[model samples]
Target: MSAAPNLVNLETVSKAYPDQVILDAVSLGVSAGQRIGVVGRNGDGKSTLLKLIARTEEPDSGRVVRTGGTTVASLGQTDTLPDASTVRSALFGDADAHEWASSPRVREVLGGLFGGLDAPSLPDGLDSRIGVLSGGERRRVDLARVLVGSADGRPASVTEGADLLLLDEPTNHLDIEGIAWLAAYLNSTKSAIVVVTHDRWFLDELCDRIWDVQGGSVFEYDGGYSAYVLARAERERQAALAEEKRQNLMRKELAWLRRGPKARTSKAKFRVDAANELIANEPPPRDAAELVSFATARLGKTVFEAHDVTVKAGDQVLLEHLDWMLGPGKRVGLVGVNGAGKTSLLRTLADATEDRRPAAGRVKVGRTVKLAWLTQHMEDLDGSWRVLESIERVAKRVQWGRKEMTAGQLAERLGFVGGRQRTLVRDLSGGQRRRLQLARLLMAEPNVLFLDEPTNDLDIETLTQLEDLLDDWPGTMIVVSHDRYFTERVADETWALLGDKRLRMLPRGIEEYLERRAEAKSDSAAPAAARAKAPSQSTIDRATQKELSKLERRLEKVEDKIAAVHADMAEFATDPGKLTELQGRLGDLERERDEIEERWMDLAD
Candidate 1:
């Protein structure tokens, strides 16, 4: 660790809103050159604590002290600039843009703050208007303002107004490349950084310290995410031990006090006081283990099939001449840039019927298929209704594990407790609304599910729980998500939404997908002269490419089957019936895998 001074310190800080106490006498400190990640459930005090550290908001009690000459910056949307404002105006505010852009130092710093940004031209550019930019572009502009300071020639150093960077959901609108660039930037910067994000990869790679905001306190763990997991488990074990000891002492004290306490004798009264104190101070019990699983019927061999499909929006063809099929136990992930029509394609597949063709395509849904599609807008839920009311509209009772559970019990397990059930959707936080939508979706028990950005506005705990739910879902799923980690964790492979109006499976995974995209971008950016001199790399015949793709997919699926058979055997080792069945299945899968391997080798030869 480098020798750096304390950047900011909090002393007995407490903050509360009308309905809840967020932070209670919580003290936290940040030092220079420290990269910290903040984690907690939704509606926890993570944001509130960040505000205190940035000095944007004061605590109800106690003081927030910062070192002399220290400066702070945070990526927040509360101060979004006017839509019609130009990029220069957005970043510089009331300062003169010409004065700042002319300075070589300021221009260099700005370029460093936002690398590879095709920002507005020097004097003026029409595309620089904030209203014309995409959501991701607007967020980048805000981030630039945070990092580069004002346009009036702010110093580009720790003495300037951006030494301590406090970011909330910084990676929300960023693509894979932007996220990678951000990770590199954070590691290279000397400023103390504290981030609140749901991106597991980001946290695991960048954070050296983790601060868990739970139970009105901040628990600090020194290390990355994996280290935090182990440390947290050990800490919980220790706490359980302490709680058990307390319970034993409390039980013995109660026995003594109850022996002969009819009269208020001095000895009896003292014992009674001790027992009452112990009862009052009993540690809270751990959360109940929540069981999440689908109660859907068995899926048929075929789920949905699209032939010669052309999925389009307006004049933009998202997919053309695409033939796709989904069978039982298929988990497909769709990835592309924004405005790539991912949700539109999902809607077409879900809404297809025998009477109506879907956007220049023929789609056939298999018999006994129960499908549910969750769009990003969550149009299925009414904004005017309360959480409980919305869920009740779906189902009042659900088959949960070994027993049937009422809506109320299910809601509590999904983290909707007490007044939360009565709270209207409009009044709930973004994460709360997402949970409500997901809870209702799961209640439907559809064997085929279509989801678009299901991880948006959700907490890490909820994400992990959803992953568990999908692992044993035993159904077909197609998910569209920008979360690299989520897709890698849940999907067997991803489908790249290519600009050539085709959806290609990427069995090599996210890294390969990113690499191909980078190569395409670089090739397109090359000068015209260079392109004319270069030989074409697309010399392979389409039929050969198609055949190779088929072999790759089949080989991967067979390998997956072999691994899964072993997993089942290990999981059900004690049951002889299951063991015998698994052994037979494993043998067949092995033979099938060998056959595919031979075919692949023959093709290669």
Candidate 2:
């Protein structure tokens, strides 16, 4: 193992806005091939540090030094692409004059996106104007920019395909497939990275170090996200112990200070000052965040039932012949390709379940059904409304058991600060607006939630916090998220939407669903030589036949014994010792039955 060279360094840098302190004399260093993750709450200078390293912004004090030859590429959280710029122009820049126009590296980066779901051999929609593209589309183009070392499709220069990459919330618009691709790239690439993302899986898999930004300073921790969690908890524990010691010393100091003036002298002046300083510098009591749990209106027995539901967009069938029932406390996660009708099915289900209306079919809902649909596109939120006003419009109050709070109070629990609550929706950042949307939904307090991509634009800390809320939620939820981790964590079952608009029920869970798909692909794509290499069916059948014959006889004997045990148990039901003995034998027979059944399936496969 060899040490990586230093790429960039920040020397006692501090950045501040007119009214708020962002970073306070924070020093950080980036090394070649280092994978660093920057994590903090919103508006906590995570992005500020990135911009400084990216050279897009400068700190008010101190300097950000970099190696003279180092090249850097930055993908910002917000899009500053010119409205007139086309996606092709933004990513491919000016490569026409150079050999870089057909660079395979560029092609390789784009090919991995969405697993060629778009163009099999080349990227698509590059000609679309940046202003006209959807949020997710624009995000893909941004990812392509840094991945290829240029914002515009231009020939890669040393600076273009930079020595270092700075990405803020890079996973904002990505799908599960896209995230997996990125995780693989970052883990493999030798280029240094300083990224701010809320995706736990990304950080856990790729990051070698974590820069935990809080209170205007970075607490550097070795290893990845899981290591950071442990390190942070230990730091807190140590701080608690030190505070306890200080409290005890303070009591003695107070008692001594209250004694007669004879106890005070010129020599003791330093002690008096030290005591006062200790009182002033003592850390305040920990202000833990409030746990979010909402009171739900009672759901009637029949939550909602959809019969023969059909939904179509233009001539494309998004859903067909769907019969679904959403019962109380049920959770379902919807997953599919980017343009797949996951959202369409979610909306259609909301109509059938809550509005009691379904296109081309009869749908019914319980008398007390309360439905809330959280759309992926949050454009319906009034841009002019203050964050608090938006929550107020949804509902004025939220209740959980005997505890209750106004919409404003609940907004704070959702990570909305005092100033942010007063900020207009249009003025908020992408992550902030997403938080606002979450706050509004919580205010609604619906018994059934329809959340489409709720994990989008959320910071990792906030994302986990939202998961905590979802875990405790006692409601029927249909969540459509590209985040497989979040979906697995919160969903009770997975519902998959295949290419043909057919819905597959997954009571077996998402992992099994993916496994079956992989196995099917393997069987279909297996070469003849690979297939022929296996034991002949005749050979397998002969051996299995012999074993099957013996197993059948053994099974019959086990069954006869099981029957005898059942009869004996009934006869000895009043005798504790005999009943226990018979029951234990019955359990052994059941285990044998399971083992034999497993062997039978293996032979069949």
Candidate 3:
């Protein structure tokens, strides 16, 4: 294959603030139409690099070179729309410029964007003010604006359209469907994209190259996120092998030098001197692993129980008629689309219900169960506070003992250090703030922990560490996440918030639940297709009967397992060892029964 065209290049780039350097002598190149993902631990200057490219921030030294006159557009955490501007004006420049607003094509586009939901009437007819929109709604409007501007509309020149897009955490407020749509759109486009995100699945699916910024340097890998991981592991393995060989050679040289004067010839003396010099010059291997420890306490058998619970905000019902019983060691995952009230439900369970009361039923929390909550937005922590001071404050509030830990120490545990703790939370990177939030959450010795999108802004290593930590945690957990990999690895049960104020409990995880739901949907649609292709009534009936029989056999197998589990329970107390084995078998059987029964119900519907 021919070499790819270099679209953007950074030469000897270095950024510094006061005495600390964020990026030092970093140089990299992006080829045309290359989808590059930038990843690193929080505060590693991944965002800084993007800023330098987008010209949002200037570097202390070095230059960014673009081979082509590619117009770049960057979307940041904060929306840049004027306070009083309407959505249409913010996107299309002005009402007069947006001639497409009156066209039927525009309405069709808007309908598609909103997933065929009824478009809320623009109060002033596309001139409605934006100040009244909710934060999530504003983000959606911002995205819509970008999409329209990039397409044929006001500011319609081809040159005005973005050739390169820099998106930092674009999925921040997006739901599952929105994220999927964005991914599909990006994949279908030829725009050179540089995205800074902590979503592994997004990076894996969209990026053609990976740029890892770590320890004041950038390492470029010519592959996807998973390939980058494999490359890093292999590099570490090779380094380890080389270090071992050097150490062995040094040991042998030292042993020879320790022999008598007979071994101290000119050659022997030179070899000894070389060995000593090599040993002195050798640097220790980098200790890259992060060790995060949370002093979480264990709870009693019964953690929490809710019966016929209804949670609502004002008159809006989030979830109703729900009965949930969580044991001491259950790890539950709350999975749903955005605005599905996952956060509200979690807050209700966490007893942050002073503003909104439970409509009906009772919530009984275990006496010894202490709850720790991590909100989706880390804005709960004071932005002006230093990282260490924030952790210290949380430690004090939680009554942690007088063995005060420095911010550096806490950050080191979270895989961050090097003057980052001294930086204000406002100045800290997104990942840095996330780590600080996690550190603060860990300081609370809660047996039941609730996390809202905890995987956001986390690196693969950090994610792995979190999984290990959660695995070792003897606490009940309710994690709200859109990450399928994380949910599959960490959760034992899944709760989905379907529309119409309904919630369903799935025994399996998000992946299995989605699979079963898809299968059921296909099954439900097949009869209509069969009817359309009917040759005769008798032939159609025969085909339908065969299909029904296949389904019945599957149902019978599930019923047989349920019946077998009941029969096996009758012999649970016969013998000591045999009873223990039978009891374990019965538990497995019960879990299987629940999964099968749930799927069967969906199929029946």
Candidate 4:
């Protein structure tokens, strides 16, 4: 019956940098339990907007209001964890183990992000030094630190979650499974979430509202990324129709004015104004399709052939006696859990250049294949060079649909517009540098492309553009990405390395791979004998049994509420305000259900 109070509010907020005006005269609010996804091109102020909400950054003009004593937790794109500090110290400071160790939520966070306390990646568990961890491991630690909320050395019951969570590219370095876990965790949180990420599937699944930041303003759209895209397309269609009518009217007006001197003098001023208004209101033409015709070297029938390829990492065999072939124009997507040797396989294929090597068996490569490997490492780039300069090193000019594009134009097409082309590579953001690399790679016109974690630092816009570019590529492509949507978009076939010393093909794509992983995990979780037997209830006390029964009833009620919420959401699909409210209610119900389940598990144990 009452409106939810705002946790943070921005009133006529204006922020600008020396070179760019990021946000101008923007007004927005974040209420309790709101999940907002911020999406735009790189350097489009999405992260800046989050900072303003968290009060970590001040606006150049106007005011940002926050509720009294509201606690905020934020994860920036860059990891700020001290390399010298242990994971436990970075996460909980000097807090005792009893504080968070006893917390089920904290344990869940650890398990979801880092594969539990005893994960191989964390060889020393909480005591592992941050400096020893790889990039992905460090990223997970940074995320887990924010996600565990605040323990304060208190008991789990006394711990409190943040009122608002601001996440910038939170899904970075996260595998598909990890992303799913995070989505579930965030959905079950009572805290409001404002996340800036390029993962479209993540946005569509978790966010109730979408914020499109562009041209120094924030445009709000109801529902998820799909809804936002549809709304935008409809708006463009309506504008096109209006422009057509205006064009016809302007033509008529001009014709009448040209009839005679009398006709010109009759309503000349009115005609002139009308024509001017129409001309001023005319919209610019839309950009052409991203990918254009590029001359690719002809590929022979034998693009790449693997004969009894057995690849290994140390003693861990990744591929065992595997025979495979990559034909000309074959597009493949490689996916597996972290540490599952996807990168190893990619390198093995790329390295089979000179001979059918004895070390890893035989892999025959076609002679005409010009291979381009876009690796995750940005170290390949010379930071001192400008964006355009780096691209020009590959080629000064490229063919685009019967037209030539200078290195600068090619850079702009890849998202380095005007002044950005002049910026030093070292000064560019992670995403900018990725785009620059892609531009350079495309300039080479390689017939075969090997992309490893290509979506690492790219925005959704850039990802979409890259997909468009790849759509028309007349070459063999092998992509390894954690972003599901991008992989599905670019690759025609999906393959998985499930850590079983095999490279398996999945006809149904990622869905099938996930099912197989789920089945394997389930099978490996317990022995057949244990799974066949039920836990005895004789150990439970009368009071505990009663509590368990009550929890079961509560869970049933919660399930009903969930079903009802889903129906309400579907019914109010056209009403954004009502849909947002319903989404919040659903999240609360889900959280309640999860708490009840956890309590039940505790009681049974």
Best by TM-score: 4
Q: For candidate 1, lDDT tens digit of each residue in 1-605? A: 65789989999999999978889998888988888999988878888888888777899999999988777878774446578987766666556556466654445445543432324221123236777765766777777666665312342332244668888888877766567667766776667889998886677668888998887888998765544544554466468733543334334323322332221122121234544554454332211122112223365566788999887654335678879987766778888644455666676677673345666868887876778777677555667999998898999987644557678766766678788899888888877887888889878867778887888988776676566455545567888877776776667668887566787888776766778877876776576335323322445466755665566556555654554455455345346888778778878878987887676555544
Candidate 2 is scored at a TM of 0.69
Worst window of 10 by summed lDDT in candidate 4: 284-293
Which residue segments of model 4 deviate by more than 4 Å? 79-85, 93-96, 117-120, 151-159, 236-297, 356-360, 379-386, 399-409, 424-427, 528-605
Angstrom error at residue 95, model 3: 8.4
TM-score of each: 0.71, 0.69, 0.65, 0.74
Best candidate, lDDT: 4
Model 3, 97-201: lDDT tens per residue?
Answer: 446555443444344344321233222324557887667667766665554444322342322346677888777666554565577677766678899887766
lDDT string, candidate 4, 260-343, tens digits: 224123322233453444345432221222221232236767788889988754333567788898887778999986556677
**Weakest ten-residue segment in model 2 by summed lDDT:** 284-293
lDDT of the candidates, in the order given: 0.67, 0.67, 0.62, 0.73
Model 2 lDDT per residue over 379-412, tens place = 5677888988888987898764345779877777
Worst 10 residues of 1 by lDDT: 284-293
Superposed by TM-score, candidate 4 places the C-alpha of residue 392 at a distance from the truth, in angstroms, of: 3.3
What range of 10 consecutive residues in model 3 has the weakest lDDT sum?
284-293
Question: Any runs in candidate 2 off by more than 4 Å, and if so which?
Answer: 79-104, 114-135, 151-154, 157-161, 241-297, 353-361, 379-396, 401-408, 417-430, 507-605
**Error of model 4, residue 191, in angstroms:** 1.7
